[model samples]
Target: MVRRAKLVNDAVELVPVLQLFSTETYRRVYETLLSEWRTLEELKQLYGEGVEEALRILKNAGMLEIKWRMPSDPAGKPEKEYHVSYTHLSINVYISLKELNTILNAIFMAEDEESEIVDRILEQIGRGRISVQHISRETGLDNLFIRALAKKSLKLNLKGQLVEPAKNEEV
Candidate 1:
């Protein structure tokens, strides 16, 4: 088999691909196909019942393909052989910035106990402008993080070096 690469993005296909080596049977079946094409019965004889499952998973993930193999002699039964399609695999793990924000928002929603942390930070800010260091000392959040959360997240209205969260609470 030539070296072919498969790109797996969906979770359904990715699980089996990632487990190809660790799952034992999947690795065996894949290696078997890599060496040469084999019929279902040939695979069954070597790996037993698990061969079917491994083939199904590998086939669905674009790692294997089926081809018919005919007997050399007359009146002999033909067989369906499984061949490997790809010898290499590639995975995509990048998530869009919008998706990342959605996930972060879910974990930090101001509800019940989680709201206390938000309230604590909000309380540190007075109606008048205050320094990021003051908020960090009171809330235990880092100074740089405080500035980012203020301007980027809480939409704090900044006046030069200082910010007033009282104005952000309105938004």
Candidate 2:
């Protein structure tokens, strides 16, 4: 039980982990882990016998992995513990004019219009992608300004360039 609680707590500590699973599953697993450690049977019953199925799905989707530990008992080892390993997904996002406008509106609601500040924050937090913060810092613009500029930039955007053009080729 303590082990299960620990595992759930670890997942909860990482917001992305919670986001990886469906809300209901996250809530139920959280609640269950918070309580006494449940046997596989108990877990199955709690999840309408779909616990295994759910794990299978999560595993297959590369979203989660489970590790089983042997129970400490005189009898032959039982599946003692189950731990969930969550995978972080990386997705490249290309924003259309409309989407860029939406994001700009959402981030610019602050009275200070810390658009530039926000962009800097995003850039600093980039995960193989440029964030608003990066754009803001690079261009010395506010979040709103950066956002607008980014929209314009995207309009003229070429697909991500994998290899830089050689000196002789057009830039």
Candidate 3:
């Protein structure tokens, strides 16, 4: 079953698969799989055997393209390898520093809390739809209060503006 969950801000959404890749693992595999076409052995060497399954997950998510064939040579058969394919999504989920932190935090907090709001805030911020002034005025809260909340959860620094957290700190 494919489960589609709306992104908090509704700009981006997620398709739930049984095999969920962590943010870092997803980037590593995506880069490797796209940069140079590799057989499952090469992937297992760099990312571990678990990556074969991860690749299948991405394929099912429509994020990867797979090529499978059993070649019979005059002397012996050759193993199958995958080819690089264009990623369909335009929003670069891997490039943004702040959004990465927000996603990581959400993953950690998924058990006891509703961190979808964090993703919503990030999506709006990324789209330039939400601003610090707007957030403060809309919520009728002070800048410090908002920043504190952001810090506690997403670790973002919303002092001057609702900006991303420092790369050194983890939420």
Candidate 4:
């Protein structure tokens, strides 16, 4: 007896939710839940032990909704499935110059091979408001990846004449 979770809120707080899944396994479990509702057994099988605990934490935080299903067979037991409740997750991040530098520093800490493109994108965006096409042309990065990362990771406001960091988000 699976049912769609009610979308009571349009968005949820992302940072605290992110904090809940600090470990890689917990993150993987949460990502799996985002894709689709799954039974505890299914999650446990897919993610190994401690998945039940992770699901419980997410459910308690209102990030997941659980529906119980009573078995049709006389001797069978009840089962539960979990679904992500919110349509969006919002993070009110105040990215100061120091924080931005920290992010850049962390990116720089990665292997040079992997950080080259990321470094270029950050450098281009740091210059001023720019179009994804312009950034792509300048950075030699794929436009789609640049666009998505700018909007998602960098929190760019893409609706205006020029792409810019979202207003009220200090950089």
Largest TM-score belongs to which candidate?
A: 1
For 1-171, candidate 1 gives per-residue lDDT tens digits of: 588888755322344454456468878988989989899889989888778767765654557788889999879987889888888877665655664454344334444644464456667664332777777777676554454344332324334446565331210
lDDT of 1 at 116: 62
Model 4 lowest lDDT segment of ten = 7-16
Off by over 4 Å in 4: 1-15, 92-171
Residue 5 alpha-carbon offset, candidate 2, angstroms: 21
What lDDT score belongs to each candidate, Candidate 1 first? 0.61, 0.40, 0.49, 0.56
lDDT of 4 by residue, 1-171 (tens): 333443322112232254345567678877777778788788888889877657655653567777877889989997878866654544445545654443344333334544465556657778862777888788775554454333333234443224565454211
Measured with C-alpha atoms, the lDDT of residue 40 in candidate 3 is 74
Q: Rank by lDDT, descending?
A: 1, 4, 3, 2
The residue-level lDDT of candidate 1 at 138 comes to 72
> Tens digits of per-residue lDDT for model 2 on 13-51?
222232325447544653564444445566766766545
| Root-mean-square deviation of candidate 3 | 14.5
Q: Which candidate would rank higher by lDDT, 2 or 3? A: 3
Regarding TM-score, does 1 or 2 come out ahead? 1
Off by over 4 Å in 1: 10-12, 96-171
